[model samples]
Target: MGVLPLVHALVPNSVGNLGSLLETVLPWAGLAVPFALLAALRRRSASAAVAAGVAAVLWLGAFWPVVAAGAAADEPNLTVVTHNVGAENADPAGTARTLLAAGPDLVALEEITDDALPAYRKALDKALPHSVRIGTVALWSRHPLTDTRRVVLDPGWSRSLRAEVRTPGGTVAVYVVHLPSVRVGLFGFGTAARDRNIQELDRVLAQERQDKVLLLGDLNGSAADRSLAPLVRRLKPVQDAVGGGFGLSWPAAFPLTRLDHVLGRGVVAVESWTLGGTGSDHLPVAARVRV
Candidate 1:
């Protein structure tokens, strides 16, 4: 029983890659696996087996990372904000105003439509002088952007993109992604498409040579999900840096689970938090990092 906490904490951070449905179930399953192994090894009593199973399940699903805070940093800072403004978002002006007020050095937006683009452009034009938009995902920055290119996450879907921003501190490769959403059914979690998207993203992240990388998106799954392992393995989640909790982001009104995130690699997080309502289904997430 004492070793359970240690086992739970040491498990590689693969759980976040599992997507949404599997996100909830796999950890619980992971917890039970150890107990089942113990039962087989010791031929333990039924009650002992049940108790071990429960402990493992709890440790995997609710503890560990939940208690781990983001890494500390000491250097120049860059503030970034990410939000998935719903496709049919009505208050583009208000959302833009709110985000601009945050004074982020970089901003990534997803689910942008032609109709709302103009309003957003007008609203952010003064603060964010440089910008790039591909399909529905876009990046706006206070600094110049170089080596900008549309990252082909899926030949079938033309929405994600990657760009290198030239900040005073250094060049940071930023990827703005809107992964496919997953669905739940009687049998179990269904995430074939989301998994494929993650694989494509994995290839992109693997090939990156830049020292600093920032991934901002509506991942549709929390760090606890396993399907996002490809990205999670390489990048550190911002929420885990500056402690406050999960920073739940979906269903802005009463967020219970974190769906949007700001992940970084070769960069240190200074602070991270959820932005207030954006008139969309998701609440925006922002992070300050030292590059």
Candidate 2:
């Protein structure tokens, strides 16, 4: 487990997409070191203690930055928020108010149903005047949105969109996406659909001409997963810049892994954090950045 992060890419996924599974819960592996160390102390085994210490070192070496992020502080220039206000969310209007309370300059939402769209629009229209939406994904900006269009990653439907936000700082391109979901069934990691979408999204991102870009929404995969390496390599995760928090944003009741993320290129993330549940299964993710 200690070495999983370094060799995650090399781990074969032909069987069950084990590599992706391990990466999804990679941070949790550090918990094992404490148990190992306790066992070593109880047994008074020098070799066991040495092994535990080594594991501790390796785990800390890889994740210390995430631990340190808790202390990060900054006066941000722009704030962006992203949330998957579940299709079945009981309180879409309340959720919209929760997001508005964060005072984000830009907001991206996913899994928005036709029924809930009106509630969201009514709640956010006045504050965030400019908006663009296609299919279930939407982008709302406090500034003007221009050159807006639907980004068709999958044919016959729209689940992604791109818009240019003319903010006081400058014009920045923002892409809001809701990638295919990943499920773990009897067949193993059911990520074929999600993986395909990731590749398609990567292709679209590659051709982007914007000097500054922000990608937000439910990616359905962890940033640590090798399958998401292409996008992770191209854009920096805002959580990483904060220096010390996992920013896990899913299963709001008891979030285990981060499915929602705020990623950007040609921008600096000064602060990043996750918000409380908004009557949805997933929590909202927020980032304050300098564009």
The CA root-mean-square deviation of candidate 1, after full C-alpha superposition on the true structure, stands at 6.4
Per-residue lDDT of model 2, residues 10-125, tens digit only: 87788899889878878888888889989999999999989999888988888888768554354667899999999999999999989988999999999989999999999999
Worst 10 residues of 1 by lDDT: 17-26
Question: Which one is best on TM-score?
Answer: 2
* Global lDDT of each candidate: 0.80, 0.88
Report how far off residue 96 is in candidate 2 (Å). Answer: 1.2
List TM-scores for all candidates, in order. Answer: 0.80, 0.95
Angstrom error of the Cα, residue 190, model 2: value is 1.1
Q: Which residue pairs collide in model 2, if any?
A: 66-244, 68-243, 69-243, 69-244, 70-244
| Shift in Å, residue 262, candidate 2 | 0.8
Candidate achieving the largest lDDT: 2
